[model samples]
Target chain A: MPTDKEHVHNRIAVLRAERGVSRRDLATALGVHYQTIGYLERGEYSPSLHLALRIAAYFEVPVEVVFSLTPFPRLGSTT
Target chain B: MKGTTMEPTSRKQKAEALREESRRRAAERQQRRDEIIRATIDQEVAPRWASRAGRRRLVGLAAGLLALPWAAVVVCWYLAPSDTAMWATFALCLAAALGFTLIANPLMKVTRGVAGAPDRLLDERQITERLRAQALAHRATLALLVAASILVSTAVPDEGNVATLPSAVFAVFAIALLATVAALPMLIAAWRMPDPLPDDED
Candidate 1:
């Protein structure tokens, strides 16, 4: 279920965890504040298109892989 | 013979002491970083929504602030009944406005991202939230002022005292401006907070 009207869900936390990057470290890379990263991960705020693309570029992932309008599937789920 | 061996042992002891100092410094640095992280988490993990009590307190403070200038004006009108007294009331209200700017502005900048103070850089989300809140508050203030003006015009018959009327009007506008400035940021910030995250939910 999408919490915000923006409807832009993301895998930012998962990717950052997989890469062993701290929020501060990733925020530095993305040229944003650490709290901004927290807001994005928690769905409390949605990033601009420019920021979303920049974040995707930072993680070296396709925009679709990073964000979606629908809920992401749980890892290892049968569905 | 003992002296020669003692020299090498002394060198080893010096090296060991240096290593211990280096390790201690590293531990201290790590501890400092941990403290910073803890503080950041404390700030960021606060309850998103303001409590009922918090709202009441803020409204009370705002009301008190709004009352001050009017109270001064009334006192000046009754006690002195001179142009000088009116001027004094204006000065007092101006001082109150200045005090609010000095004390409340920084607080708002830090907590609510108000005033767009550069030192405390607000993220886009905070900036947007404040803008939305201020716009609503501004409209409300404008409407209230218009209604107030109409009521005052109807109630207070024109005595053709140009000097007194203009000053009174000026004082009213100044007080209104100060009240709006003092109340808007706090109201917006208080209203924008979200509920805390439950342990089971995000």
Candidate 2:
């Protein structure tokens, strides 16, 4: 089973692409480094709920649409 | 009357000055920590996620290593025939296990303390990054320990029919396992702790 760290799956890149937003633009909007945006998109780092909400807001989407706790799944319990 | 009033006023002024100085020193110390946190955060960003994973992996490795000596002791006790070789193997395994436990236990404690320092309250990113970096360092240490065990076991000859080689191999593995697994949860917990928001928010 994946650990808690892996629970928050981010679809940052997909959202950014869907919106035709460049990494620089997103980084600027988020007030973070562009590399941070890249890292977030790649799932190398998990964002805090605040950051997740911010990202979702930036993309004008629901937080769940941009992030999920479903794919990694909890260690136990089905569905 | 005027002279008596001036004396009290001067004493009050002195007390205020001392209080101000104490507050100033506290502010300076806080500023220093803020700078350190800033630097640590900047340095930690790229490597944070990788480090947490590393800590978990390392702890697991250490735990696995810890199992080796017991296995060796049991095997040696059963064989009974090769007394000299068994004793030597047992001693070596014990030493390795003890050495690893000693080093890893303290190392984990130190890391936890550093990660949990209240002075680190800064940007949330900074705290997260520091934790992640610590985890990565821990993982790297575990990897090194595993490699070292394999190397050392290979160097030791298998000439004696006393099961020395297996014991040594298992000892290394156990130590690595113990070190890795023991430190994993703590590292994760430290990493997962929420960073305090900026003072203005409070």
Candidate 3:
């Protein structure tokens, strides 16, 4: 059922890359297995509301910056 | 000069060394990713019973419950006064059914599902496997029932006295029915487990 729904595009991979954070490192910080981080990064899994908030808190960013229904704008590109 | 020969060979060797180092690092990264994936699957996919110590207790309880009725029936069959044996068998069956409803059912409630119901502890993939297994079990049961019906109907005498059939025949049929019924749940539960990932040959 989760798979049937539209994917919730995310900036997790970009954010992790910008921070130079490996999946294992992020997973450790979040107290989840590394593959869960990989899944989240690839948009294969949608995090629960609680987990989304936790991830945003971990990154020191707002939830909207991390996840969105639409694709995020390219970094440093003119509109 | 000797220097020209040495310089070209040295350049080729350096190039080869760089390629090897790159290949090794690539292999290391792939191995790390593989390990992470395996760990995640091992952590999340296993059923509660698979990793939990409480499975042993649950198994012991189920085995004891199933065995109790058979033990009673066997003791009654051999030890009871000849006249009471049949009545004892009937009584034992009734008692077992009562015990299952009153005791074992509630004890098993955590893992319990109606024949086709999804187990709460199972993940989506496991639930899919369980459903497939349940369907197969249903089909097998249906086949068995149909075969039994045909055999029974054919074995009945032309006189139409169903009671005239041998009691041993009925007992055999009852045992078959009981075994099939008992196995269905166990089959589905066992089938729900994911297969181990096959080793990569390369």
Candidate 4:
């Protein structure tokens, strides 16, 4: 049997903030309830591949830039 | 050109009017749907459903509501407190069981976890969560039925004559079992659902 769902870290919050797009707006664009956007931003829910792609498409970015297995580096931190 | 000239202007006007009326009605329907959706979300965000502590307490209360009746039946059967005590117990327990089942069905609606809710009522995430909850509830309900069967078997003699058991006892078990089975999916979903994140400046 497969393991429990692993957390899929995402940059959705950062991207939404940078774009000045409200969670409601993003949720509407993605055809999900606004709370779902919050869940995605908090890494509590891992979106399906279709939803992930749609979210990325909404922000005009690749899915990789939006979601990753590893956490994204802290903003402005040197590697 | 001859056909166009022959067509009645009044008939054309009536058709246009009908189309306009239909459009207006459709818009009104959409507005009502949006309002209902907003109301439902607001209810979900209310303190009773939003906070973990509150939800846990409610789930526990719902459980106790059913268990209390079941326990009373068992006690009445064993102690034979009075000639009509078992019947009385079944009657009272039946009321409470029905009450809880009624409340539970609606509570699931607020959480969008009602197994019978139409697909349009839930989003993808909620749909996925509900499906998982129902699957778990199905397995749990099976276990409960198995346990109940074993307990009821004890009441039967080597003759396997269930008639020896008071018919009232059957009523007690039936109400409790039916109510539990009906409410299991809702209870399971409510208990397993995580508290929604506090609304931050969203």
Candidate 5:
């Protein structure tokens, strides 16, 4: 049912890939365990908004650019 | 241009693979924990509409049952004045029985709801917090019961009347004494134990 947390964040992996950063380096930058970085990148856990923003900031991009709401619903014409 | 690939020894490759597998497992465990927490919160805080529907059904059932006794009490009161105490006692007993039944019913449901749930939700930190709070509450209740019992025993004389003091007072004393004594072992065990799982299975 998507229980809120399932609106996954692909941001970590996307940012890491773009910057060509290793998981260990990202973990060090994030001040979290390396496994945490791996978990974040795999979308196993959704980061809090604060963590999301921090990740986006680390990538030098807007939060929207880094994180996205997936299975994007189409905007219909207003009735 | 293709470069020559260097193959690593089996032992080194095996070690590297094992480390990667361990990291993967850790990540998976953390993810599972997060998912379980999210699900629990959702269940606990189900939509207001759903909760309201359930409450309405329960209330309807209760009201239907209560109507019969209420009607009987009103009729009996008008027809027979002498049976007031009998009816009152009957009502009180019914209420006590219902209260006890209701109390016991929810324990099983709550246990089922958190069945197979991860112990991380009730981690060592949370267990310690709960034990501390419970200890304080138990002490406070024990103190109150003791004071009440002493006051009742002193104020009310052991004259011809047996039911001079409130039955509730005696019941509270008995319950508190038993609870306090029973809790001693649990408190001691909890204090002595190191990082016990909140649930038995965990």
Candidate 6:
């Protein structure tokens, strides 16, 4: 519906930790290299919408829950 | 139909079973290949060339690699050594080239997300990196070729005079430049690639 090439911050590491999924397992499930998982978590590599959706699906959460335009707040901090 | 040993339903079932087996085997093969790719990244890309220092060292080495052929050409230009010595020099340079490529190519592949990989095999991020690297390499190589061509043409002596550089040296230079052309993209991509994120759990 809209477009922006800027970075899309994600909470992959937090989600992965909460879900107890190793980077290797997540990468294997997503059909990408493990280092890609690392890159994505660190906000160095941005995923396409398709890949973003796939990742959201893998985590069984809404896409918004995984990705957001603004920086996600610290996990335990009161906003 | 009356004479047939099997009914149509049984034949269909057998065909489905065969198709299922084929699908299973294909998936199995894909999984195995994925494992190999993951292992290669873990061992080669992960263990080597991940540091800023290591990457910088390799980038410097890549510059030397580009200069390598030119160095060989210069040697031949200055001193047309004995035939045996010339051959030995060629052999040594060849070995060095091979060794350097073997060490550098993995880093390039990681940097460029499977450098030169086909479209189907690469993800969006990989495709972008590859395209950017290739575009840069193409422009750089074209400029180098043009400059070299101009220099060589200007160096050609007036009609009927002896060439300043030996014909053999020109041949060697051309060959070396050709190899450098092939190696340039990988080197550029490798140099431009950022150091990968740390491996620690985030």
Q: Tell me, by DockQ, which candidate is best.
A: 4
TM-score of chain B of each: 0.52, 0.36, 0.37, 0.65, 0.32, 0.67
- What lDDT would each prediction earn against the true structure? 0.64, 0.58, 0.59, 0.73, 0.48, 0.73
Candidate 4 all-Cα RMSD: 6.0
> Per-residue lDDT tens digits of candidate 3, residues A1-79?
1363667878988888888887778877886645556656667667778878988998999999999988788989887
Q: What DockQ number belongs to candidate 5?
A: 0.03
Clashing pairs in 6: none
- Model 2's CAPRI class is incorrect
Write down the DockQ of candidate 4.
0.55
Off by over 4 Å in 6: A1-5, A73-79, B1-38, B44-48, B78-85, B101-122, B159-165, B200-202
C-alpha lDDT of candidate 4 relative to the true structure: 0.73
Can you tell me the CAPRI class of model 6? acceptable
Residue B77 lDDT in candidate 6: 68
Off by over 4 Å in 2: A1-79, B37-57, B60-202
TM-score of each: 0.62, 0.35, 0.36, 0.73, 0.28, 0.70
- Winner of 4 and 5 under DockQ: 4
Ranking by TM-score: 4, 6, 1, 3, 2, 5
lDDT of 1 by residue, B1-202 (tens): 9999899999999999999999999989977865554343335322322344554454455456656676665555454557776776777677667756554533342343433333235556656666776787788778867986786677554677532443554555566667766576565554454433332112
Worst 10 residues of 6 chain A by lDDT: A1-10
Name the lDDT value of residue B116 in candidate 5: 24
Better of 1 and 4 by TM-score: 4
Retained true contacts (fraction), each candidate: 0.22, 0.00, 0.00, 0.39, 0.00, 0.33
What's candidate 3's i-RMS value? 7.5
Q: What residue pairs clash in candidate 3, if any at all?
A: none
Scoring model 6 with DockQ, what do you get? 0.34
Kindly list the interface RMSD, in angstroms, of each predicted candidate in the order they appear.
Answer: 5.4, 11.9, 7.5, 1.5, 12.2, 2.2
Clashes of each: 3, 25, 0, 0, 0, 0
Which run of 10 residues does model 3 chain B get worst, by summed lDDT?
B193-202
lDDT per residue as tens, model 5, B110-135: 22222223445442323343455457
List where candidate 4 sits over 4 angstroms from the true fold: A1-5, B1-38, B44-49, B68-94, B105-117, B159-163
